[model samples]
Target: MKQMTLKTTSDLSLAIAKDRFSRGTLWRFPARVPLLLLVTGLCLQMPAVWAQQQETPGKAAIPQESPFGTYGSFEKLLQAAQGGDADAQVKVSLCYGKGIGVTQDYEKAFTWAMKAAEQENAGGASIVAGCYLQGKGVEQNIPQAIEWVTKAANRGDVMAQYNLAATYYEGLYGIPKDEEKAFFWAEKAANQGDREAQCLLGVCYLTGKGVTKNLEKSAYWSQKASDQGAPAAQRNMGIFYAMGLGGLKKDVNKALELWKKAAEAGDSEAQYALGSCYAGDVEYYDPDKIYQNMPEAKKWLQKAADQGHERAKETLERLFHIKASS
Candidate 1:
């Protein structure tokens, strides 16, 4: 078995010790690729230390005394980052901020994110803005946050674009609520594969917030967002499918799929839909295939109820009583 070691004094070594997240199973979308955001710490710091230690004293010189002696995944990738991988720099910074797989340390997060931002990494700039906004490791400053977010948004960081849109829409931190600016930033983010932005843009289209009202455009954007697994989009699509809007031709199967995706992602509306789907005995609907077992139906309904969905709350109470009697 090959072993790797890190020294306690090395900045790279400390970063490796802090990044431990591996995304277990909660992530499942193209947008979720940035969960790799948490992966940066582990990716940036392990290899160089190993190489240096290996070169010095073979197996004997490897420091087992350091706290990171046990990490085994992606050590080589981390080493590459330690050697100055820009992508790795951003990832490590994210890990520091969220404490995703490692100990939460704002100072390290700020430092690493700043390093990547200086290199013009949009993702890094977004995270750094978040830190500034929240006063995490740096002093709170909305102007600074906006500057960083704008930089990243301009560079096509979808998350940054979304934040920028929110800032402009709310007029937070002296920014005026310019609908055009909101639309501009949100559209930019949506185009860059941000599911939330897609859904928000769809909503904007539906309400004619920034752009003129266009139901077809709304449906188009909603579908785009839904396909990428946006919970809000799933809910919107489910509603559309249920209502047969925008020339959709109303497919129950498609509606069910969107609801399922939304429910799995913990959307209360989707959970309620799942309950409703099970309880309704429509002539063409396959209750067995859609809701299948009553127990799962109850589980989802209860989850929605807990989230304060009124319809779900009422449904769950009735279902619970029926189950008790049965």
Candidate 2:
């Protein structure tokens, strides 16, 4: 019998770390690849109003009748903000930062965001962290970015929790890699119904990184995110169904359905898996039922290869005798 060595979650963690160091972006995996990749943390930066909603659950309903609601003309927002309304400060900062109704001015945006942050507003803290992370209006200071983000996360800011989880998971921005802390933040965010965090937590449980290895738990969390249309979690769920892992019964049809959904969402890994399935290379499918469609295979494999999926490129050259460069 061939000894099957189970790859751990650390493999995924290290891949994420390397990808972050090189690309300064999120990690993505090739389709059907054994290793999992972390979802990019870029989505952690929510719009100011959205951030406010996530941070302050069950607060007074945001007034929609006011011209100075979460968003409005720059002049009115500026006037309200100048009057020291924390919510207005956030809107005015966004106006300056994005040039929605005014000229883009990072310095002014930072100033206003800082004012709100000083008042302990979660949205303000998140913006301040983002400015520091990207050096928008201030000099790039990774430590400061992390500090502000941490403040927001501690205050039940879901996006902040997700960002901190990604940061700790990959140890990006000069932070030390800590799987335990990553799991902590991810779990917090996941419990709050953050899809990305749910996916990360599922992976953690699947691989026993900062959590006990529990395939059932992995499936549970992945399903939650997948139901919410998170592509990564959908892909993970497909893998679980295909392999019959995570307490799921082997269901090729279900796996293919999930993979197709993820592939349509532009997940490179799902594209590759779909290609492999069409190519009749995936194990457990009946040989007679496996239809070899080279064109379909090439289509999806090309999509993955275009995204720099090394194995897809290799498979194209070696098996399909086609050069991806072409």
Candidate 3:
């Protein structure tokens, strides 16, 4: 809803883009906050300028418009960036960083993003924090990254809050572990409908990390996140249904259904669940007889084993006599 403006540059620098990306930071961790790398394309994309290359009189044509981003042609986006829309400023920053409708310029991206952040926009502030964290346009500064992200979290940026929660939860980035802080931020993001945060909040409640363990609360949050297609939540929801935990009646069929969804979505744990269950290890009560003979048992189990799930690998060897080398 806001307009943005920025200094226009005709500079087409694929070399610059490549250089920035060469140094770009994208990290994923099973035990820590993910640095929001999965949100690469959450912003609105410009039209299909990607089909045609824009050539300058003396400059080589820039890369095709990235399918990943930008909302309009470069000229129009620049017009908006040059105005003063905080949201638009962030989008322009995304364009510059991603080489969407225009050439990549990390410095320009940082400038535009910071301008929006200065206006107290939560999304812009979070992007600035990401830039600092990743050293996209500036030197990597962990303290600066923490400061900016915390500021954005305080302003209720969902991603920022989720990142903060995960960081504190895992004691990552040199920060001391603080379950209270983790629970606090996780709750903030979860209440705002962030599925990942919802999944994490469920974990917190289930484990009693920052509050008393509450099965009902855990199941509630897990179901909420599962509805949004969160793999982790789906995995947990399956467990709840299978065990009849959290006030739910025993429903092995529902559990299998949820596990199938999670497994198909590439959740290693869910894959293991389906595999082990089908292999007759559930040896949990089942009247439906969705047994391993469906040939799903080995397939899902092998998928999990491929991901280095210890239990899955062991089960394959123990029951199926499948050798590890195979």
Candidate 4:
């Protein structure tokens, strides 16, 4: 058996904020009612009801009743939002931004989201920051986005903290790359029990980015995030176990198990690593299973290659070329 050298690799975590919208209410007026009359009645009553609701913005929005039972409705939600309900305001913002029950209106979404943020709602502030970042319903303003995200992070919003950390790390949207600030924000989110941040902090420790290189700390944070079912963390832990680095005992079986879990979760890197192991690239590991199952190597390698993994692509090309020639 040929002894193969393992490639040293590091996982760099990138955080991307995802926007999610809430469902809208489903209400239908009786067909017997004149459409004009129904619209007129709603217009006349909605403002007064909205004004009453605005007086207590802290109140939770009441769920609308429908034939399907309790559900969210755009009109009812907007009414509650106008009444000063932060959660409702956020929901209305989502509805407007996503065109849930009304026409897609970025301006309206920005207005409602800003209103919720003004009330010091963490989620609302995060959404506002995301909107500013992406120019979803407002003009793209990096400074404003950073300010709103900072507020949300200060309010202990884990995702906001993670976003801020990534922003600092990547120097995105005119933000200067500052590893120290990145580490600081990542630590804050990690302390708040954000698994992504924990994994990022582990990477930071391993790379000595804004901190001293410490394998033990790397292993510690990676294990913490791994225990939370973070695929990236699991993959990193698998690498550590395989290489006996980060104060972990070398355990090929454990490495395989972790890689399998991460691979199943669609992690291309883990798929590549698993493929490498199956191809007998992991030094000192048993090669019997791998030798008996070359197709398994190709399967995992193909999966990784399909995801645009350069190394996997190179390996697979070389592998098949050699097989064809033989």
Per-model TM-score on C-alpha atoms? 0.62, 0.79, 0.77, 0.76
Worst 10 residues of 1 by lDDT: 8-17
- Judged by TM-score, which candidate is best? 2
- Predicted candidate 3 versus true structure: per-residue lDDT over 132-245, tens digit per residue: 776878777777877887888888776677777777876666779899998998899789887767877887877787988888998899899889776667878888887787
- The best candidate in terms of lDDT: 2
Clashes by residue pair, model 2: 31-269
lDDT string, candidate 4, 163-226, tens digits: 7776676666677989999899889978877676787798889888889988899889989888
lDDT by residue (48-140, candidate 2, tens digit) is 112221222222233344433443456876887798877677666766665656777888888998898898877678778888877878887
lDDT of each: 0.58, 0.67, 0.64, 0.65
Runs with alpha carbons beyond 4 Å of true place in candidate 2: 1-23, 26-72, 288-290
Q: What is the total number of backbone clashes in candidate 1?
A: 8
Those runs of model 1 whose alpha carbons end farther than 4 Å from true positions after fitting are 1-105, 169-178, 281-299, 316-326
Report the Cα RMSD per candidate: 15.8, 8.1, 14.8, 11.4
